[model samples]
Target: MTGHTAFGWRTFLLRWSGEWADSLPHDEARDPDDEAARRARWLGFPPASQERVTAMEERLGRRMPPSYRSFLLVTDGWRHAGGFVWLLAGTADARRHDNESELADMYEEDLDEDAGPEEWREAGIWRRGLQLDVRSDATYVLLDPEDVDEDGEWAVYTWASWRADAPKRYTDFGSFMEAMYREFHSLRAHRTGREPAFVNDTTRELDARVDEARRDALRGDWERALKTLDEAEEYGRPRARGLGDQIRRLLGRTHLVYFPDVVTDPRYAPELLPPLAAEHAAHSYRGDASLTFPLRGADDALVSQVFATLEQVRAGAYRYTAPGPFGEAVDRARELARWGDTDQAWRTLTDALPLWRPLGPDHLVPLGWVADPVLGPLLTVERGRELLSTPRGGHPGEAPAPTPGLDPPGLAWLVDPGPGGGRGPYRFVLVEGVEPEDLPARLGDEDAEGAALDAPRTLREARWHLPRGPRESSSYEDRPVMAVGRAGAGWSFAFDGDPAPFAPRRFVSPAASAAAGTRAVVVWSDLGARRGESFFHLSVARDGTREYAFTCTDGEIRRTGDIPRALDPDRFFAVPGAGAAAERPLLEAVAEHFGVRLPRHALLNGRLHTVTTRSWTRPPRDGETYLVWSMA
Candidate 1:
């Protein structure tokens, strides 16, 4: 009957780490025996008070919500009534109760986690925990899910409450419902969705407002509910279930706000409220991390941005966080380290060294190894040379400037050990990683549009700038960006669009087709943008030989007569003097030798010329030769 006393409360108050449900008030604010008070005290019912126990159990059978069952089993918030108080234990309260709540609640509720319904039946321990409280007019015990009567469907559990103590049991919800209907004509079938439009109760308007807020919340109308819940809370007043928890759970699920700091505070626990002085402290830990900086400018800007983001991530400060992009960036960095450009990888390592401090050892050390696989051995040698200031015999200065022009440069081997005499097909294949600045100058025309991104690129960066080719849009929203068409022999050249004129710098070449057979000879002409809309000619030789020629000019092989005159008879069919003196022209040559008339205007006045020469035999041991020329 006093401010600090538990004079009429059923359960004693105790401090818990997290939040704890407050004890429900029983009779007597001193001895007040109302319906709500009866339900509140039902938990304290003793085994001898069967009538009170049975009534409370029946009332509970009528009022619990459905999702509570699933959430209870999964989270652990079990509880039971004993004497004048309820004893609870379960998963939902594990963190708060040191896992004790789980055992007490489960046992009192007759929930045998280890046994199924069939097992419980076979073991005959199915008599649920329905205890009676002899002192009260009514008391009840809640039945666990597994202990439910077989005929009960919608009614999943039972409880008891009584006007006075007696020994009686109800096997089904029907028995409880029949008793309730008989005693109180007000009893109605509580079909969940069939609640009437209005019930003439003093709290009807308040209930409507709360129901409306709940509906808004379930529909993800957070902003609307936020506005409405203020009014709903006022209406629900002192006895209402806290709307703050619902709001907190919703906001957390939507990730629209920080975790439920204020609502989850102990003040909302149906008891004393505290001032808003308390604030949660942040939890911080260190581990490896990766970062991607989206820099859109020149090379220097790119490098600086990349370095800065890496630095910040290393410093353990970031906003709007998610794990996926960071993980992907780390993976990409690892892959980049695997490339042959050990020096570049080293530079990357040096740039990102600051971030490595926060990362765990596994990520940091492996990153270094990835960046410089040879560094371990080099370290051993370098360790031996304590005074690195002394001059070494073979000191190579700065590396030579890259070769300029049309051809992509071959990969350089600065300290290769001649493969250490290893012999395999490894000699034929090559891997080249070109610096962005050197790439366009090496492959595309000087005046070509949209060639600004010549540096190294992230996949995101590449998607933003690359042509994406004719078959697909540049947006790259489609599922799989990389695809291999059906294999075939002929080569197919694809362009992002009808390519512009060669422009003295840009030119096209046929790509190797999907097939591995004889390649198609592609000749791209109509070279000017006007009529030269990116068309190509397929030149197939009868002898299974082919040649691809891309040009912007017409040629001199105009008439059949000009074909013979154009043929270089000395090299056409006759072998040179040093080798076999005479030999028939190769079939491709025969076509050229016999006077094949070229298309009209098929000449480009000195537009193209053969840039390479091939010999079928050793020079002095001469063999028949074929001519390649460019004409206007």
Candidate 2:
């Protein structure tokens, strides 16, 4: 196992003749015709005589490693080992390569210069390494003289000229040759229409073992099955390698990397790809070219087709699409995830998954990416109910007309620790006639927006301005930091300043005054430690007037103007014995009464348009604490 693979390579190479390598995936730059011609001559030259090996060893004044010696005894040289390397030299050509010194220097230069002279001295290079291949296309195979093992085996390297990078290293010549053997099968695995190949008796046994392992996996004996597959991979068994990876994917040990044949193989993919893609996208860097998959989660026609195929095999996974961009729900997911509310975060994604669309008509990637790393850990099974439910997708309807003073039922989750969504202290004004996109400019995002226009952010990452606890009171923190974005038809302007949003409290009037035409509904809830410990402020403002307002601070209540018919002072203050003891139920009634809704996902998760309005002069009587939450 150390010198070369513990297998009969002589017999294996014998069967790798004629059109055997035809199934291998071709390098894009190479000619298919030329590749086929080269592959037709897969077998190596005849075995070298012992005397010839001895003479070559004496010329180099070194004893050849056991693996290379055995390889030459089997065949003097070989042609076309893997995707690269057209030839492997025999003893007849075994000598110091002409450009060995230059190649070694370049390889050494690729190392870290910051390591200093002591570390740099042991660069582990081969200035005159024995070259082992010929006619190679910018790819060299060399053996390092200084990198020998206890078994007298010299380390081998496969380097290329085009890439100014480090070479791929191997333990010995046999290990390198075995890598080529494995690469052959890996390249061929990309194609279809060919049955599995069996090269020798050992390969036949490997095929049998892999088949047994698959059966064991289906029987829920995955541990044993995985062990068998792992053993088979040591011999470069392709079936075992793929099956092991797929099994690990199911066991949550790895990702599939990409979609395989779901229809033909049809086991691990259909049941999991959608959720897995979201999970993958959630964990990976946003907008990375490698992670870019078509955002087709909303394409009902194609999604239905895929779900139907999965259904035939009894696989069940939901596809999610939001009323608008999936990023809204994704934002909510990140927010909830940061709060350690994983189950709700997951629900946020799945509930918003019903409608998705492909980037193009011919999009083939099974699932689109979610594109948010903050939401990565937001996955879990909720007592199996989440898995048991029927999956649902579809587009959002037209935004409902803004209903001032009404809190949509969804807002109840903000204070509840239950499965319902939860959030920190929030202050907002829900208003109509204010464009969601326009809020950015109104909120002083002109600078941020201008910067954004110059260089847009990644698709998956949303902005969060939450700053908890006592910290720096810098001027940046001195000014208000609010995220304004669309909430259904209306716009929600939420503040994330130190502790709270408004400093003198009357500042809420100017914010609501910014609304055009109709009056704005302003709401603020004090940060709470327990369920009913909230100090809430509910106000209706029109052009600088705090018309019809109710305030509950430190258990005291105040009301001004003609209270709207929607008023319910008892619910806003909370009544423990009234069964409306919890802040969540009371808030639910408050929201229901006002009939206005804000997408909490956008406020907490989305990187909405933020701004710092002109600061107001604090009248001395405004309060001793006029220096409270103020944005720059």
Candidate 3:
């Protein structure tokens, strides 16, 4: 037998034995004479002679494939598992293992008399195959001698005597063995609750060394653990590379240095501590699958040192460019603060301005860092100042003043407006008591109730206060409100309740509207009614300069030329008969007056009647005396 054949047989023995040993139940005693053990012993016997292989071939009247023949030279017979114990027939058992005769007999006994010629050929599986394994269970490993290729290798198959169907086939014996071995290993691993590591005789010593290293690591003797792993590497350099690295990292935990409180301390000088600390910190953060050591587990003094280093680096005291350890330190400090040492966390952050500055205008600190009441107030104040100083575009002190003549009404009209801009959809609130006769005049009067004259107010002037509720609802209540105007043909209606009315909302050009001749504005009570819950008010100045304004209960208020296509009133109202015919006169009047198409449905749904008149002292009741208007 050749060296290659001997090696292959030996590898098979080691793998089979390893799987069996690993798979045995802990509570069950293993038998030394078990089938797996018996086969392993047989494989160690002298290689089969050429004459013996030839004699077995003659008895079967068919030659074994080259790969199988080579395997036979190493070990003539073997047994293993995959659902069933597979038995490879040897030269000594050739006469009894002659499966060709048995196959022919099975074909004759099971052939269907009514089957078509092609069907019969397919069903006569026994005629084309030879059973290699002897089993009472009726499932057999088969070899298809009739399907031999140019290489003289027969196809292998697995056949079940109980099922009268063609056997499942494989390309050759080598592939068949390989597939069986993989499945066997997987099955054994599952049963044993441990992964099966294949170790042949050649690498047995190296594997033993690895096992010793693992034991050492578990006991925390990292020095000895790594040394043992190095010995394994000497025997298997390339293959042991990953194992070597893993051991080193595991051993590295012993040397982990905590963040020192003082940078100037002799123990924490740049050359002595940073490099070693960085390496150990990285490993600690990564964590071992078996042993985990968190950074917060370090003493408070050490943690203080870590932050001190970070602060020094931030202040350009030490040019520590590596961000990994620094980031880890921040995360560790935050974690510690979350677990109750918030003051230390705050101090760490206050000194690490360089790290926080790069985090953007918000200088977003971790939520835990600011959750502490004592630390929260101080941090927020400082953070807010830092954010305000961040250069956005204009100088920090040069914020543009509010647009003139655009203030909202009383405190009720004021909203929180949130951080970015004014909140909520642009909406209109009809100012009652003003009539059509007040056209173009009352809108310009600074003293007129709800007029544009009283519109421009500062945030302080609004004096808006918040009410408590579910967070989202309460937050919305704080949005700042602003007044809006409609440029009508001869008059305009003041919409004082809109939240956002500037560019991106109403496109305010304070200078543009002022330069244009005074536009006629009507506080049309009935016109607001003819329009819907939310209506479009067209304000036309005496100079014929017209401006279009559409109010929505929610969403941004879009101006004349910049309205999105989806919001186009024509799309919703262009269809005929969409609104009551009685309102057509008022719709036509507003559309014709403004020189634009009118949204009739919008007029019909206007919330004008919902307004409470400024002159009325009490809420209106059914049949009570109240000011009423007629569009006619």
Count of backbone clashes, every candidate in sequence:
50, 29, 44
Write down the lDDT of every candidate, Cα atoms only. 0.26, 0.52, 0.40
Error of 2 at 172 (Å): 0.8
Question: Model 3, 60: alpha-carbon shift in Å?
Answer: 1.9
Clashes of 1: 50
Residue-level lDDT tens digits of model 1 in 190-252: 112433322333245555665565444334343465566554443332112344333432222
Residues 305-343 of candidate 2 have per-residue lDDT tens digits of 444433322211233322355558766765554322444
Count of backbone collisions within predicted model 3: 44
lDDT, model 1, position 377: 13
TM-score against native, each model: 0.22, 0.47, 0.29
lDDT of 3 by residue, 137-200 (tens): 4666766766677887777777666677766777877667665655554444334243334444
Query: Highest lDDT: which candidate?
Result: 2
On lDDT, the stronger of 1 and 2 is 2
| 200: Cα error in model 3, Å | 9.6
Candidate 3 lDDT for residue 284: 41
By TM-score, the best candidate is: 2
